[model samples]
Target: MSSSLPLSGRVGIITGGARGIGYAIAKRLLQDGASVCLWDVDETALSEAKASLSSLGNVATAQVNVTDAASVEAAVQTTLAALGKIDLLVNNAGIAGNNAKLWELTPEEWRRVLDINLNGPFLCCRGVVPQMLKNGFGRIVNIASVAGKEGNPNASHYSASKAGVIGLTKSLGKELATSNILVNCITPAVIETDILKQMTQQHVDYMLSKIPMNRFGQKEEAAAMVAWLCSEDCSFTTGAVFDLSGGRATY
Candidate 1:
């Protein structure tokens, strides 16, 4: 590891850190010299990810249900006890609910997706913001989606959830701008991650077709943007939306 890495001496909590884009971000942060705690609801995946990432840097795992207040509070306490202080928060835990139009979707399905995608981040922010305030420094990066910018067909719930995330990021960013706790989000186009498994083939093809790049993005690519946002170099920006859309986003 390079001594001059940007994130050296930093510690981060990554929700949904067990797999997909979350896993990639954890690995990147570790490589950048930050100790990371992988927070996930999946104990099995957490074990596997911990084993795989332990060799790279300091790593910890905790089973967390981001949608639950008590669960998030406990995870925060555990991370603080283990890592001592948290410098970064990556709200990467979200689910792609079933693919269906608004009329076709059940209330249960809608709430489930919103609970994890929107409420989860809200809980995490509530849980961790005080710690950041105490330290007088922090970076929060929410993993929003391009779908949030332009709602996708048959994925209304997922799109709405991510849009809420973006709204949360902007509002929080402004509130904390003077406190040095930066809050921002990335709107990435379709990335090739396990979340894709939940989407139908037709939906997948439609997403790909919308990307001007003519391809799905890689998890590593999203991680790279997130890494930069998590670093001190991103100081001037907060309450902002970054585009990782493969030219799919016009605004």
Candidate 2:
């Protein structure tokens, strides 16, 4: 790898890295000269992702259930074993649970989304931060959503979960401010990804209508922003939310 590449010699862990936005981020990071460890619950997809991405750079995969602390910890160890050290973490594993009004949703449904979308990142950070601190450098870029800010109707669970992610990023960022471990998050309006499949057509259309650009964002666009946030170029910013909302974000 060329020393001039921004992420050269870095090792990163990307949860939900088997596909969609996560896969795009992994590919971008690899192309930027970082080795990557893909963590996902789907073993088959993990294998496929590793096979496809191995040509770009050093790539490894671990079947992980982000919601489980044991699973997250084991994957952290696995990544350390495979890649030596972790310089970046992208908390991207999440789901758009079945759309329903807040009152109509079952407690189980609400908890499931929170467990994966919020608590998962918490565990991964807890597991990975020690290594980053030991190395005295790290970056954490969480994948939040515009819904978290606006709170889309019928997706109360997802919106709340992502909101928690934003809160987590801010608190963690402040906690690591002087440690050289920058933490931040991105709030994307609507990216074209498999997660969309879990939403109703009405909901998708409603989200699309809210964007001033009138077009869905591509996964690569999200990947590009995340790549920068994971690099040394993002040195001065931490605990901030970068908007990828195509002009939909009012704040």
Candidate 3:
């Protein structure tokens, strides 16, 4: 099926494209024939990722902090200027919030999570939508988490932030559905990423045990979905939340 993938001339901007799932998605998009702007906070990783993806296809790098509105706005503009079009926007920049119980979590940590996970998407959407609406075509896929749907005991902040992303996706999706734009979200179970390092063994154990599939999700699988959703193939779905939960989620 992938041999006939249809995104031949799209331009995309993927936040957090420095590494992990974001980089995986970026690579997949390029492989499917898309010009990409890989944005991230880590300058070094962004450079490396850009260099790596350039060998696959056209890829540009931007060092921008998604949590900062000004930085995100400028980055969005730079992407548009450099690419000449913005066919896809993937709001994949986020941090795993504090793992403490809700009552024990600090305000700083909570705000950090909210700012990066929720507000970052908000800023990106706000910045990119006008261009999309102007062009009368756009595809946005936000990377949420299964934790958002079923709250985790120790990850209250992370869970809440993702829930907020889901809410944001729904609201924006509805608002833009009248146009030729599509907005969607994906809820993925534990995929292999450095974020796992932020979790305790007990936390990881609990997550693993709850998975009916009994294993971690692969980055390629999720990346495949992201690439498709960012393509013209996803015309019929809007305001939807897809699950890549390894059988751990049902609804």
Candidate 4:
């Protein structure tokens, strides 16, 4: 059966696209026929990601630290210069800073996590939204976490950052509601990715035990939701939170 691709002719920028869930989302978007620009902090990983994903379709690579406005702005310009215009944005770049109790966590650690996980998306949006507004169309997907909803005990930093992301999604969605731009977020519980290495074994076990499915989510599963949210098919839904927690989320 012949099927038409919904994202054909679209161009997208995926932050943290070098690996993990971000990598999977890039691959999925490519399969759906969108030209993808992979943005990451690691130049080596970005090169490897671009190489691996090139066979799927048009691909570009950029080194960006999303938390830095200058870095993000430069990347946006580069992406526009290369891809013409950005039609979609996937804010997936984030860090699972050292796991520790709220009291045990240092102020520096908290700021670092917020800078990358929360400030990163804000900066990326600030850089890209102007172009999207000019084009009159865009899709933004911020990858959040179930911890944002539940507030994990030892992961205050991660949880708080994601919660901010959720709040950002809602507010931005409303601001762009009348426009052709759609802003939404996904909250997944414990996806099995290299980011897991950042967490302690005890922390990992705690997260897994909370998942009703008794297992961590797959990167592909999260990627699928992102692909859909970025497509025209996702029209009418903006500033919404799509749950990918595998029965872990109550609401």
Question: For residues 103-208, could you state the per-residue lDDT of candidate 4 as single tens digits?
Answer: 9999999999999999999999999999999999999999999999999999999999999999999999999999899999999999999999998999999999
Relative to the true structure, how large is the alpha-carbon lDDT of every model?
0.96, 0.96, 0.89, 0.95
lDDT value, candidate 1, whole model: 0.96
lDDT, candidate 2, at 237: 97
* Global fold similarity of model 1 (TM-score): 0.99
Write the number of the candidate with greater lDDT, choosing between 3 and 4.
4
Alpha-carbon RMSD to native, per candidate: 0.7, 0.5, 1.8, 1.4
Error of 4 at 139 (Å): 0.5
Q: Give the residue spans of candidate 1 off by over 4 A.
A: none
Instruction: Identify the superior model by lDDT, candidate 2 or candidate 4.
Output: 2
In Å, residue 34's CA in model 3 sits off its true spot by 0.5
Estimate, for each residue in 135-227, the C-alpha lDDT of model 3 and write its tens digit.
Answer: 999999999999999988889889999999999999999999889899999999999899899889889899999899899998899999998
TM-scores for every candidate against the unseen true structure: 0.99, 0.99, 0.97, 0.98
Which of the two, 1 or 3, has more lDDT? 1
Q: What is the clash count for each candidate, in the order shown?
A: 0, 0, 0, 0
Overlapping backbone residue pairs in candidate 4 total 0
> Model 4, residue 98: displacement in angstroms?
0.7
* Runs with alpha carbons beyond 4 Å of true place in candidate 2: none
